[model samples]
Target: MANTTDDTTLALDAVKGEHPTDIFSLDGEGDWSPHITESNLPTKIIWSPTMGFSTVDKDVLAICEEAISELEKAGVEVVVNDSIWEVNPVESWMVFWACARARAQQHLIGTEEYESIDPLLRLFIEMGVTMDGASYASAIDACHHYNYQLEEAFQESPLIITPATCGQPPKLEGDGFVNGEETASWVDFTMGINMTRNPAGVIPVGNLDNNLPVAIQIIGQQRADLDVLKAMKAFEEVINFRERAEDF
Candidate 1:
């Protein structure tokens, strides 16, 4: 497992400029505080394709509809934003991330080799997935693109809400696979924000039958993640969105 602390340091460097990095920032500043009390809170919200609402499985969809209605019943409003696919294609992000991984591996894999880079690019090209905006060819480029988008989105709202995973949090315990098996690897919707260097925290909404809990991810712009956290704390007091049996 990559040392969590090491990954955090590298991720933070990508955000705050080099050297003299803000201590409060390299550490964390918490969420953005747009308002102080309940009366002043913005009723505005934004949601994107989540646990459901974008497929034709036709089965298990009732579960999704009921879940959405429950959220509304709990006094929380749903804000629909971009589709799940807007974030980036699974292949593109993975391929791009793999290149970054490979570059990080180069020095250790002996003589500055680009061994890992070639295949990912070739696979992406062969699949005919648009590589026009992909940075899979260059590790720096991929990280740069990820960072750029993070800044762009958060710049608008000191906060933005997105599904914690394109799906749900994986069963964290399973036959080990660094990032999990191929089938589960791409569930990391949270990582893009991680790669951006903002402090994001997750709170359990409730559990799914398989026992994995769903979490709503709160993200903040720049150095104001603490405000996001604070808002989440506030949100919990008034809204009780949960599973039918979640008794909370």
Candidate 2:
């Protein structure tokens, strides 16, 4: 939501508030300081090569590796751990996401409002409404299991790194290219984290051959937003990517 760690904190503080109807909002108060000073940099972090995917584009993988090398040169230990999640949580996450969307928009089904919705979103709503409650419960169970796996990973290393996206930015009106294939599912890297509600940050690591920027995802243990920001700031300093697109 912001260009820098300081800006992120400022934006969050401005909008963070309690609402009687918003049950999901955090209930208690705690320190929000980013603690991004040089002395507070993470000593060790985990890097998942494929980010729980079957394969990632070779160029994107190389960019992540180069970022890891830079962090190592800055005295941070980068541990290679490909098997972050034993059971891939993408399917379960999709089921849960679809069901949530259905719950919110199901009332409009068969109405003119429904016809006005985008076709892809209408498909999602249809998928959600047809899903059985037992399946939804199963998805919830699977998500809990995945959350436990992430908690274990956090115990070993407070932070985990992965490619922010599977490949370069997609065209404005077309699917993304990954591993030489055009696909719409190029964003699976962040699904598990979203399903588990972990705190994640992204920083521009480098630009692709086409001049589009590529970034790495730094995910922290649930509720460890400050630590994630600290790592992002530390790594941001190491990479020092300050170039702006000339057209912008």
Which numbered prediction scores highest in lDDT against the true structure? 2
Off by over 4 Å in 2: 17-19, 28-34, 111-113, 246-248
Once fitted onto the true fold, the runs of candidate 1 whose alpha carbons sit more than 4 angstroms away are: 1-42, 50-77, 84-158, 168-182, 239-248
lDDT: worst 10-residue window of model 2: 27-36
**Per-residue lDDT for 1-248 in model 2, tens only?**
76776677667666665668888887545445545564567899998877554467778879878989999998888888888776657788879878888999999999999999988888888899999989988987887787888788777789989888886678887777787787766676777888778889898888888888888999988888878888888788888888776664
Residue lDDT tens for model 1, 116-211: 456654443433343333354554455566666656544334555654544533355432121233234334554455455666754445455556
**Please, what is the TM-score per model?**
0.50, 0.90
lDDT for residue 238 in candidate 1, whole number 0-100: 45
